[model samples]
Target: MAISIFGLLEVMLLFINAVAILNEERFLAKIGWGRQAANPYEQESVKARIVNLITAVSTLMRIPLIGLNIIVILYLVVLG
Candidate 1:
């Protein structure tokens, strides 16, 4: 029972790690795309603001996911 549970835990950890890695990659890609996007209205400050805006929103959204992931990891460890 415990061994199966550990396997499940490993899978979950891999999933979360993949999600985190994907998110980071997506974040970088978005930043690069945004930088290259044509926009006459985008001044230096506006570009900075847009970058920060995207990052802030993404970070805020990811906070709960990360917290839940941590909780699950802890739960699995304690379950052992």
Candidate 2:
């Protein structure tokens, strides 16, 4: 019973790590795309504000996700 539980925990950890890596890659891609898109919007004031606002909001939402991820990793490492 104990061994099965540990096996499950290890699987969960692998899944979480994969998800974190994918999210990081997607985020970096989005930032790169945003940077490339800036030049085209240089003459547009309203569009720039909207784009910046969206980016800011998305970044804010990621804070809790990152924190939770860290906590989960610590829990798995120390207790599992």
Candidate 3:
């Protein structure tokens, strides 16, 4: 039962991660493929900063999620 619950949580996290990645790509497209603008100020605008932060956070989330997923898979294969 606990394993099943954890598996469900993992799936939810994976979905959230996918959505975050999609949003990041969308934001980057809106901002010109993450290119730096000619105007320095434009390069550091609020939208740009928010996108950067989101990228960083989503990247960080990926590492742990991948690790957790591997652990869960191994657990199921070895003991399920």
Candidate 4:
């Protein structure tokens, strides 16, 4: 089955983001932050800060991809 260009682009964007998150998690684990916690608020705060940074950058990255997806879907709908 052939995937639409927009669909392929969307998959690629998601794949890249997943890889980045995996890498970030690995790096955090390497630095002793194995995962989220609840005991120490400071640890949770650090994780939250990292999450906020990732979310900010991901939002910027997603804006263009989302715009592209919308444009492509609209084009397909209009042409079809």
Estimate, for each residue in 6-80, the C-alpha lDDT of model 4 and write its tens digit.
678768766656634544455655765443422355644766666556555555656566666577678769986
Question: Judged by lDDT against the true structure, how good is candidate 2?
Answer: 0.57
> Model 3, which residues run further than 4 Å from truth?
1-4, 26-56
lDDT of 3: 0.65
Q: Is candidate 1 or candidate 2 better by TM-score?
A: 1
lDDT of 1 at 30: 68
Among the numbered candidates, top TM-score falls to: 3
Model 1 Cα RMSD, Å?
Answer: 8.7
Task: Give the CA lDDT, 0 to 100, for residue 5 in model 4.
Answer: 83
Which 10 consecutive positions of candidate 1 have the poorest summed lDDT? Answer: 16-25
Off by over 4 Å in 2: 1-60
Q: Of the candidates shown, which would achieve the greatest lDDT relative to the real structure?
A: 3
Candidate 1 — number of clashing residue pairs?
A: 0
* Tens digit of per-residue lDDT, candidate 2, span 44-73: 666555555545545664565566668767
lDDT score, residue 61, model 1? 48
Q: What is the TM-score of each candidate against the true structure?
A: 0.32, 0.30, 0.43, 0.32
**lDDT of candidate 1 vs native?**
0.59
Candidate 2 scores a C-alpha RMSD against the true structure in Å of 9.0
